[model samples]
Target: MPALDKIRWENYARNLAKGMTQADAYEDAGFTRSKQAASALANNPVILQRVEELRTERERILSGPTVFDEDADTDNGEPLVEVTMEWVIERLAANVVSAQSTGNHSAANKALEMLGHHLGLSFSDKKAPSGDEGKPGSNLGSGNTFNILSLTEGLKQHAAALEQMPMKDVTPEDDG
Candidate 1:
């Protein structure tokens, strides 16, 4: 068999990297449309290597940071840093600390929760069985032990107290 044309091989590899089907790419590379021929060409060691190279190059280009300004270039910019799992975790940890220092308990809690979830230390709403089933004052086995009646009554009382109390502006001022 004669060696494949360099242009056709490059075209086929480019098409494959662009998500084209083997048969479609082979045809687009100026080859006769035959499923068997396309499959054979696609499975060729040289073609497969070229396709992998193209895919890797495409990924490198896509993962790079984008520059919005047409006149600006990234040639002299700082080295590109890939976003890793460790980097994300560190940022989240810093956020938790920063929020706590600023007296934002809610934000700190949220950041801590996110960090916990990312680290696989997730908190679940489902309660574990306590082996206290059928015991007095133990509502184990039945989902949720809190008294609904008492909860509703408490909420009503709290609402009434809030209505009786004087309202104050609690919104934080923008530091920016």
Candidate 2:
């Protein structure tokens, strides 16, 4: 039941800038008044704007420029699209964390949506796992997800792409 308050989001993004996982950010925020922190931060519009600015900037640096619209056709003040690698890395690693306490599909979906928005792209979880076994899910060998296996050709097409990725950026889990 973690609530996203302005201060908490700012703090979380700050920690993320320091390479902390989202789960750790949830538990490790230095909140002197945890109960009222959300309300307090919400009242300060400046802080909220700052949070969005910083987060969006970091998100831009995480993903490649091809994802953005070079034309900037419609709005003069429109910001560039950004794809933060933090969420993807966390989701991918969560698969190996047996005792993981903080993770959810909703959060994962939001991350992917945010990334797509930054890329001016749209992607559905066509391979998202289901209880029914027959339904197709992301298979590493089959190359369903836009992950390492699928990106191999693209990586070879452009050698520079492999160098720009964020730390520990890898393929996410099949279920997410």
Candidate 3:
């Protein structure tokens, strides 16, 4: 293929990696807008390989640990740490305690809300209908009703389980 065509193909693959639709990527790569041509190129083995490479590279770049620094200059400050899900949860938990100690019920509730969400608790505005309603021996109550003590215990158990699990290392070098 010509050098310009190769460049266009690379651009098309890059665009695909960036989550563009095949037709959109083709047009964005300077190719005339044609669904048939886009489909054909998408199916090409060389283009497919290139697209896969670009996607893998993108994933590697995105999967790196995130570092949050309050100051732009990192020469003389606290050591940088990788911000993981556990780290975020710890921060939220701390915020909840801090807010509660300061008599900020609103802030404490907000922190607890965020912590609940992070812990996979579903907070739906609408309550789901419990099919057991109207059945014999069924304790009929609001569908959204839950035992706060049990829920809190369950969350504690879940947090303990998560703590026991090993964290996965996702560095690019580990791919090999």
Candidate 4:
């Protein structure tokens, strides 16, 4: 019936914006206990407006910046800001330097070999994909009867259904 205090409403709005329940926000705002009172305060027009504003502000902050453009092949021939070849090389060099400083030749060599796969400087540790088609060794081995992604998804659903089925009950006479 009456408007909530400005400070309490603001506190309630902030908590509500963070996905807290209305009742929780009401109590957390430091208001006196009473479900009916809390409910009435939460439903007040001014409190509702504050909650909306806080929610909008939160949405804006979460969606702002820190987004990657996956469609673009490269950042105009420039190395990516994160995970660039130069970055990897720099890290490997740093590892070697750190190892050498501690008189750990093994560690230094290990760092060098870390990037060996990409640079072809050392033997690859990856298992070479066998030329077998539809076999266990390959991605879609002999067991995989269907190659279509949609069909594969259906097979997964079927497997899930099989797992959900109750086990068959057996009696001693039935077993015999």
Candidate 5:
């Protein structure tokens, strides 16, 4: 039960890191909230520590491994390299241009194919239907209206409301 309580506290902390209010995190973790009890809980030294720990862990996970070069060149001049998507794409493009200039048709074709695949212009998971078969409302594909911007705006509004709401009591039955 103590372990379970700690897990709940961690969950609340994670939620709080995602911009939820203290009261919202408290209620979200299935804990009952009194008039000022939520504030008291949020201020608890142990809970605060856990919250910081959770936030730090989340940051670490999101950041992944660092891209660093031990042989990095400064003004002294040495080998320097950066491994990034943009850098890789630019190198590929340069290779294609060089191949073309040198009349290396095979190398140019390979580089172009690689670039096209990376940019999702080639190699689809499913074979696209031919002619009218690919059209929306056809037997091959369904016509579904999707407005991503509208959906994102709706979610932001809902999240704002959730953040503003005060904590509420969580019954034992509901918690289970």
Candidate 6:
């Protein structure tokens, strides 16, 4: 129950994120056998519950962030700090599609979860997106179907997932 240092990991965490297993991230982050000892804590219910509180605080700090808003004009436009589930998916899609080169949904979703962290959205990559999230003039693609995003992330995530998916599953279907 100790307090998190709030240590600014900066880009350090991102570097370790090049398609790492949750196990890898847990170790690389320097927790000492804690992920194993506190496996339940790994998916901490309390942490998830306080997400809204943390998010609001994060927004307050990032309100005037140094990163320039690409879709904004200096005087008229407001910074669109989009924190949508769909946007999170799109962001993670890069890795998802790459990992899914051989075709897999599970791998793509894992990629999405990791990438979602970077995008300030905590979501599972497995959960497919629904309607009404797409923006005006935006073609965010349909479902978890074979889209560029999922396809790409799948390629990266497949390094782990493929190892998990047994070779027997890849056999050509028997046509009876």
Q: Who wins the lDDT comparison?
A: 3
Model 6: runs farther than 4 Å from truth? 1-25, 32-39, 50-52, 65-176
Worst 10 residues of 5 by lDDT: 140-149
In model 3, residue pairs whose N, Cα or C atoms come closer than 3 Å (at least 3 residues apart or on different chains), thus clashing, are: none
> Clash number for every model?
0, 1, 0, 4, 0, 23
Query: What are the TM-scores, per candidate, against the unseen true structure?
Result: 0.36, 0.24, 0.36, 0.35, 0.34, 0.20
lDDT of 3: 0.65
Flag the better candidate by TM-score, 3 or 6: 3
Positional deviation of 94 in candidate 6, in angstroms?
44
Q: Which stretches of model 5 miss by more than 4 angstroms?
A: 1-5, 64-176
Q: Give the Cα lDDT of each candidate.
A: 0.62, 0.45, 0.65, 0.56, 0.56, 0.44
Candidate 2 colliding pairs:
82-118
Looking at model 3, residue 42 earns an lDDT score of 90
The segments of candidate 2 whose C-alpha lies over 4 angstroms from its true place after superposition are 1-27, 65-176
Root-mean-square deviation per candidate: 17.3, 17.0, 15.3, 21.6, 22.6, 20.2
| Residue 95 lDDT, candidate 2, scale 0-100 | 28
lDDT tens per residue, model 2, 1-176? 12234555557545544565445644566654353554454346554554456566556555564234343321212344444465443433332231122456566445444534444444444543555446554332233345433333432433343235444525457795
lDDT of 3 by residue, 1-176 (tens): 21124778878877876889999999999999998999999998888877777666556545777565443222212234567787777666656655776799999778777876665564555433677666643452333235334446755665566567554433247455
**Sorted by TM-score, highest first, which candidate order results?**
3, 1, 4, 5, 2, 6
By lDDT, highest first, what's the ranking?
Answer: 3, 1, 5, 4, 2, 6
Candidate 1 stretches with Cα past 4 Å from truth are: 1-5, 66-176
Task: Name the regions of candidate 4 deviating beyond 4 angstroms.
Answer: 1-5, 66-176
lDDT per residue (tens digit) for residues 45-87 in model 5: 7777766665665565446543434545422122345467865
User: Model 6, 30-93: lDDT tens per residue?
Assistant: 5543446334433555433333344444456457543344543332122445466654544455
Residue pairs of candidate 1 with colliding backbone atoms: none
